[model samples]
Target: MDVAEGPSSSSVVSEQTIEAGHTLLLKMPTGDVRPHKIEKDTTVNLGKFGSFHANHLIGQPYGLTYDIVDKSLKVVPPRPIQEVEDTEATNELINDGEFVQPLTSEEIEELKKQGLPADEIVKRQIEQHANYQLKTEYSKEKYKKRKVAKYSKGFSTVIPALYNVCEYWFNKDATRLRDIRPDALSQILNLASIRPGGRYLCVDDASGIVVTGILQRLAGEGRLITICDIESPPAYPCMVQMNFPKEHTAVISSLNWATADEDYTPIVASSEPPTGKFKSEGQKSRLNKRKVASDMLMRHREELFAGEFDGLVIASQYDPWSILERLYPYLGGSASIVVHSPQVQILSDLHAKLRDLPGYLGPSLTEGFLRRYQVLPGRTHPTMNTSGTGGFILHAIKVYDDPNASSVMAHRQKAKKAKLEAEANANAAPATSSAEPERPVSDETLAETTQPIESSDAAMES
Candidate 1:
C-alpha cells in the first residue's frame, strides 16, 4: 500500500509573502503594532499615519517599511542601525523651558492640513528651534527620533510570527496573557521540549497564548489534546489571530475536564446511518455535519483515554497541583512537564508539592526577566522603562516508580546464584550411575534454562 505524505516545505515557505486575507501586524513609527486582515481593494486605516489601499500590500514581502504619500504606500529602504559618535557639546547651558521652539502647535497642525509631509514639518521645527545648535550629536538624534515618532507617516509590515504576536499582545494588554513576555514564552516552549511529531497535553487559560505557541512549534505534525471546561468551547483567541493553516489547526483536539476521568463514559452516537432521505438538502447536510462532529469527538475521547502522551503543559488559572495530579498518569515515562503562572507563589507551592510525588523528578521553579537597551557609541544603556516580570514557570520530568522493583531484582539475583553453586558442585563431583540417567538437554530446554527472567513490574512501568 502507498503511504500519504505531508505538505512540502515550499508550500509552508510561501507564507513569507503578504497575501490577501492573511492577518498581518502593522508596526507604526511610534513602536506600536496592530493586527489587521488584508483584503483585496480595501483601505487599511493607520490612524494618524494615514490610510493606504490594501491591494498595494497584497504581494509584498514582510519586514519592509513603507511611506504613506497621497494616501498610497511606497516602499522605502530600512534605516541602518549604527553607533553615533559623541560631539564636543554639553547640556550644561541648555535651557529647560517649553517655549524653546518658535513653531507653535497650531502651526504644526496647519502644516499637516496643508498636506505637507512629516519630514518637511520636522525640518521646519528644527530650523525654528532656538537651541538646536548647542545639543550634542546623541541628543540631536534623540530629538529627531522623538519628532519622527510623533509625525512620521511610515509603517512596517510585520509577519505574525510567535515572537511578534506575543510582543503585540504584551504591549497592548499584558494582563490578557497573564504577563507572559516573549522571552518567557520561548522558555516555556524550550522547557516543555515542544517539537514536531510529539503528542502533548495542554490546559491553557491565558487566551490560548501557550496553546498557540505549541501549535506553531508542532508545525502541523503532532497531536495537542487541550483540556477545557465542559460548559464552553476553548477560548483560543490568540490561536485564531495566528491564522494558521487548516493542517496546523487540525492537530488540536479538545477534551473536557469532566470527561477526562477514567470511569466517565461519553454518550456514543448511533452507528447505523439514517434510514430515509431528509425532507430537504439543507436538512440532510445539517444532520451529516452533526454526525461527523460526533464521530470526531468520540475518536478524540478514545485517544485521550488511551494515555501515554509525550509531555504536558499547563498555564491555567485553576490550581496547578490539582491539574497536574489529574493529568499526571497520562504522560509517558521521562516525559517533560511544564506549568506557568503569573504569581511565583503558585509555582513555588507546586514545585514543593511535586518533590514529594513518587513519579516526578527535578521539579524546579524559575522566573524570566527581560530588558531592552539602546545601543550607540558612548551612549549605550538599558531602556528606562522595561517589562516587569514575565511570570514564573515550573518544569520537571515524569518517571516510573515500580513498587515491586526491588523484590523482583533480589529474587532474580538469588536464583542466578543458586544455579551457579549447583553447577560448581556438579563439576566437582565425579560421573556416577545417578548422573547416567541425565538425558541430553534439547535445544528448546537449554534455551529456556538460559533465558533471563524479566520483572513484570518493570514491563508495566515501561
Candidate 2:
C-alpha cells in the first residue's frame, strides 16, 4: 500500500494476509465511503491512480488506497469489504461493448453439422490450435455483435504473424514460436532438469496448445506426460494421433484416483464447469449455477495427482488464483513453472510467495515488456488489458525444502546477531526511497503492458 497525497485527497494503505477476501477502498480518504456496490472478484480502478482486488481488503482497518503497479495491486490503505450495488451492468457494458445473445439457432446448426456445439468447438480449437482459433473466433461472434456499433474490425486480423504466434505456441516447432529461439528453450529446459523419461503434467486452458508443444519439443527423450481437463476435445483424439503416434497418447476419463499407465503421452481436456457454478468446497474448484465446495475438488486432485511429476504447467485463463493454490502443492518436490498472461493477478502474487527462490524470471519476466507496454499505471487497458480480463505468464520452480541445521544457521547468522547497525542504514529499506518512483516512459514499455493485442486500428488505418 502507498500514500498518494494530491490536492484533493490523501490516502494510506494496509495489506491484509493472503487469501483474506476482497479489497476495499474508501474514497475522499474519509469514513466508510465506498464506490457504489463494489463488484465481487472485481477490479476497482482508480484511473491515473491505482486499482486493487475488491475482495482482498475486506475486514482491513478502515481508510486505505491500493496501487495497481503492473497488473497486481498492493493495498496501501485497507478497509473491510463494503457492500456496493452490483456493478454487473457496468461490467457487462464494458465486456460486451454491447451485449449480444448467445449463439443463434442457424449458427448453432451450422456448427453442429460440422462437428459439436459451436462454442465447444471454438474452445477446443483454441486449446489444440490457438493460431487456428485466433484466426477463426471472429466469425463465431460476427452475428451476435452485428447490431453493436463499431466492433466490426476483426479482434485479430489475419496477420501472418498472428498465425505464426499460434502455431509457434504448440510443441517442438522452433520456426513457429517466433521470438523464442531454440537457445532460450534449451536454457529453460536445462534449468528445469528435464531429461528423457521425466514425468510431466500440464493443465493449460489455451487448447492444450502450449502443453502439446512442450511435449512435441521434448519428444523421443523418454518423457511421460499427463493432462487434466473438465471439457472434452472435439478433434483432440485425431489431433493427438496426427501429432504424435497413438501409442504415446492416452486420454484419461477421470481426473480422480483413476490412473493411466506410468508411461504415457500427454493428457488433454478442458477445465470448464461440468455442472453448476459452485460445487462442494474441495481441492479443485468450479463455478456455475451450482457451486461445489473446495473440499471435493481437493479430494479429487489428490486422488489423481498424488504421484510424482517432474514438471507442472498451468494455462487456465480463469481462476489462476484458485488454480495455483490447488496445483502448487503437487509440484512440492520439483520446480513448477506457471505460464499465464500478465493480466492474471496470481502470477505476480505467486512470484511474491516464492520470495526465497532466488533468480526467477518472475521479478523481471515481463518487467521489460511492462516497462515498455503498460505505461501510466492508470489508464492503459489495451486488448490484453488488466481491468480484470488480461493475464500474464508466471514461472516458479518448486524444489526440495528441508531444514538443514547448518544451512539455516549459516544464512541466519547475519540476522541472528541482528545489530541495529545505524539510524539510517537499513538494508530492508526499499530501493526507491528518495528516488521518485519512475513511471515507464517508453512507447515499447507502454505497449508491452497495455495488452497482448495484435494491431487492429493501426492496421485498419494503414
**Per-residue lDDT tens digits of candidate 2, residues 1-462?**
345754442221222222233222234221112322345577655442335555644444433344334435455443353333322222221332333334455654465455352336445333443232232233333322332211110111111121222333332332233222323333334444555556555554454444444544454454433344443222322122122433334422124112222233334333444573435655134342122323433443554466556666555545555554555555536455645543435556655655544322233233213212423223244445322212344556565544342233333444543443343455542222211123444577777788666668988677
Model 1: how far residue 202 lies from native, Å? 0.6
Instruction: Evaluate all candidate structures by whole-model CA lDDT and list the values in order.
Output: 0.82, 0.39
> Residue-wise lDDT of candidate 1 within 254-316, one digit each (tens)?
888876766777675554346765767787777788788778877887888788999999988
Q: What is the TM-score of each candidate against the true structure?
A: 0.82, 0.33
Q: In candidate 1, residue 345 scores what lDDT?
A: 88
Candidate 1 segments exceeding 4 Å error: 1-9, 98-100, 230-232, 267-283, 404-462
Candidate whose lDDT is highest: 1
- Weakest 10 consecutive residues, lDDT, candidate 1? 428-437
Can you tell me which runs of candidate 2 are displaced by over 4 Å? 1-165, 168-195, 218-242, 250-304, 342-346, 356-364, 367-391, 403-462
